[model samples]
Target: MLDFINRVLGRESGGSKEIAKERLRLVLVHDRASVSPQLLQALKTDLIQVISKYMDIDEKAMEVTLDSNERQVALVASIPVKSMKRATRTPAVSI
Candidate 1:
């Protein structure tokens, strides 16, 4: 994809070697960050809860993905905004 983009932009292709190097760079980033897919999912869930307090959100539409290079991992998340509404009123009961 990078090569194709470079070519389309009239830039020299980095070639397979450059592509491999780039992959390694990303992997290293991921490794150093310690952000794996599982971690990202947990982070996404927490984020949704925190953000939901102020606004509505579609939990199903939430996205938490990870990309890794040779030694690095990157965490990416996408959450859509939703309308906020109060739930039905309930009568209080003594414990």
Candidate 2:
């Protein structure tokens, strides 16, 4: 990808350096949170199961990542919903 090429060539755009720094920070935050890849996968699976009860989602397109700042770590999910299901016994999630 273009990003790989740019990194290989040591070419940093005006904001790419900051973006790289933020990525490194996120890695450190994940380490501090003790969130392993397996744990993240497990969480993603749980989210899919729970959310699927009320909506049809594109599992292949779903993304779940951890974002952090100086004070807190946040779970960020980008799930593509195909359609919403009718009201059922399962409670709907509120943002």
Candidate 2 overall lDDT versus native? 0.89
Each model's number of backbone clashes? 13, 0
Candidate 2 lDDT for residue 10: 91
Worst 10 residues of 1 by lDDT: 84-93
lDDT of 2 by residue, 24-80 (tens): 988988888888999999999999999998899999999998888768789999999
Error of 1 at 62 (Å): 2.0
For the record, the alpha-carbon RMSD of candidate 1 to the native fold, in angstroms, is 8.2
lDDT of each: 0.74, 0.89
Candidate with top lDDT is 2
After best superposition, candidate 2 residue 75: deviation in angstroms? 1.3
Candidate 1 residue spans exceeding 4 A from truth? 1-32, 65-76, 84-95
